[model samples]
Target: MKKLGRLEFFWAILIVITLFNTFLGEQFASTALVSVLVSITVMYKGLVVIDYFMELKHANKNLRWLMRLYFIIFPSMIIATVFF
Candidate 1:
C-alpha cells in the first residue's frame, strides 16, 4: 500500500467535509445550528485551501495572514447575514 501525501490527506478531508455539508444542507431546513455548522466548515475549508492548495504557508507573513483573515471574515459575514 502507498502512503498518502500531505496534499492528498487534506484533499480527502475536504471531500469528507463537503459531503457532510451537502448532507446537512439536504437534511436540515436552514436552522441556526445548521447555519453555524456550515459556516464553521466553510471557514475550515477556506483555511485549508489557503494554506495548502495556495501554498501560502511559507509565504510572507502579511500575505498569509491576509488570506486567513478572509476565511474568518466571510464566515462571520455568513452568520451575520443568516441572523440579521
Candidate 2:
C-alpha cells in the first residue's frame, strides 16, 4: 500500500468533509451549530488548499500571509453574521 502524499491527504479530507456537510445539511436542524461546524471545516480546507495545492507553503511570506488573512477574515465575517 502506497502512502498518501500531502496533497492527496488533504484532498481526501476535503472530500470527506464535503460529504459530511451534505448529510448534515439534509437534517437541517440547529442552524447555528451547523454553520459553525461548516465554517471550521471550510477554513481547514481552505488553509490546506492554500498551503499545498496553491504551493504557498514556501512562497513569499507576504503572499502567504495575505491568503491566510483572507481565509480567516472571510469565514469570520460569515460566522459573525450568522450568529449576530
Candidate 3:
C-alpha cells in the first residue's frame, strides 16, 4: 500500500466509493437508508481531500475537531427521525 503514491491511493479509494454507491443505490434505494445520500457522497470526497490533498495526517496537530460536529448531526438526525 505504501508503494502507491498519494494520488494513486486516492484514485483507488475513489474507485471503491464509486462501486459502493452504484451497488448501494441499486440494492437499497427502496429500503430504509441510514444516511442522507448526499452526505454519504460528501463524506467520501471530504475524506479523500483531507487525507490526500490537505495531508492532514502529516500537518500540525491542532485539527478543528469541532467542525466534524456538523457531520455527526446527520446520523443523529436520522436516528431521531426513526425514533420520534
Candidate 4:
C-alpha cells in the first residue's frame, strides 16, 4: 500500500462527494431539505476544489478570497432560487 498525497486525498474526497450528490439527487424528491443539503455539499465541493485542487490555499489572499466568494455566493443563490 502507498500513501496518498494532499492532492490525491482531496481528489478522493471530491469523488465521494460527487457520488453522494448523485445519490441524493436520484433518491429523493425536490424539497427544501434536499435542496439545502445539495447546496451545502456543492459549497463544500467548491471550496475543496478552490483551496486544494486549484492550489489556492496558500496563494494571494485577495485572489483566494475572490474565488472562495464565488462558491459561497453561487450556492446561496441556488438555495435562494429554490425558495423564491
Candidate 5:
C-alpha cells in the first residue's frame, strides 16, 4: 500500500472532523457553541482544500490572501446567519 503524504493525512483529518460534526449536529440541538465549532471546522477544511487540493500553497501572495479571506468571510457569514 502507498504511504499517505501530509496532504492525504490532512484530508483524512478533514473527513473525520466532518463526520464528527455531522454526528454532533444530529445528536445535539443547535446551540451557539455548536455553531461556532462548525464554523471553525468549515474554515479549517476550506484552508486545507485551498492549500493542497487547489494547489494554492505556492500561489501568488494576492491570490492566497484572497482565498484565505474568502474562507474566513464565508464561514463568518454562515455563523451570522445561524445567530441572526
Candidate 6:
C-alpha cells in the first residue's frame, strides 16, 4: 500500500488542466463543449482521488460495489428518466 496520499498527483494534474483551460479561455470562447470536457476530466481525476486519497482500495468489496454502482446506476437512471 502507498504510504502517501495521492493529493500531490491530483493537484498537479488539476493545475495542468487549469492552465490548459486558462490558455483556452484566452483564445477560445469557453463554450459548452469545453466545459463538458473539463467536467469529464474533473470526474476522472475524482475517481483517482477516491481510490488513493480515500484508500478505497482497502475497503470492503460491498462498499466498493456500492460506490461503483453510484457512478453507473445514478447516471443511467437520470438518462432513463429524461428519455421516458
TM-score of each: 0.89, 0.85, 0.51, 0.88, 0.86, 0.51
Tens-digit lDDT string for candidate 1 (1-84): 243488899999999999999999999898888889999999999999988899898878899999999899989887887767
* Colliding pairs, model 3: none
Q: Put down candidate 2 lDDT per residue, 1-84, tens digits, no spaces.
A: 243476678889999999988887888885887888887888888888899888898999899999999999877776786767
Q: lDDT (CA) for every model shown? A: 0.90, 0.84, 0.59, 0.87, 0.88, 0.62
- Backbone clashes in model 1: 0
lDDT of 3 by residue, 1-84 (tens): 573586887887878777776777677753346345534665656656655666765565456243344445654565455445
Expressed as tens digits, the lDDT of each residue in 1-84 for candidate 4 is 243487788788889988998898999988888888889999999999888778798998898999999999999987997877
Model 2 residue 80 distance off true place after TM-score fit, in angstroms: 0.8
lDDT score for residue 13 of model 4: 86
Best by TM-score: 1
RMSD of each: 2.3, 2.3, 4.1, 2.2, 2.4, 5.2
**Cα shift from native, residue 22, model 6 (Å):** 4.4
lDDT by residue (1-84, candidate 5, tens digit) is 243487689889899989989987999999888888899999999998998888898988899899999999988887897758
Q: List, residue by residue over 5-66, the lDDT tens digit for candidate 6.
A: 45676668767877876776688775665655555555555566656666686788787667
Model 5 spans with C-alpha error above 4 angstroms: 1-4
Clashes of each: 0, 0, 0, 0, 0, 0
lDDT of 1: 0.90
Worst 10 residues of 1 by lDDT: 1-10
Kindly report which residue stretches of model 4 are placed more than 4 angstroms away from their true locations once superposed: 1-4
Best by lDDT: 1
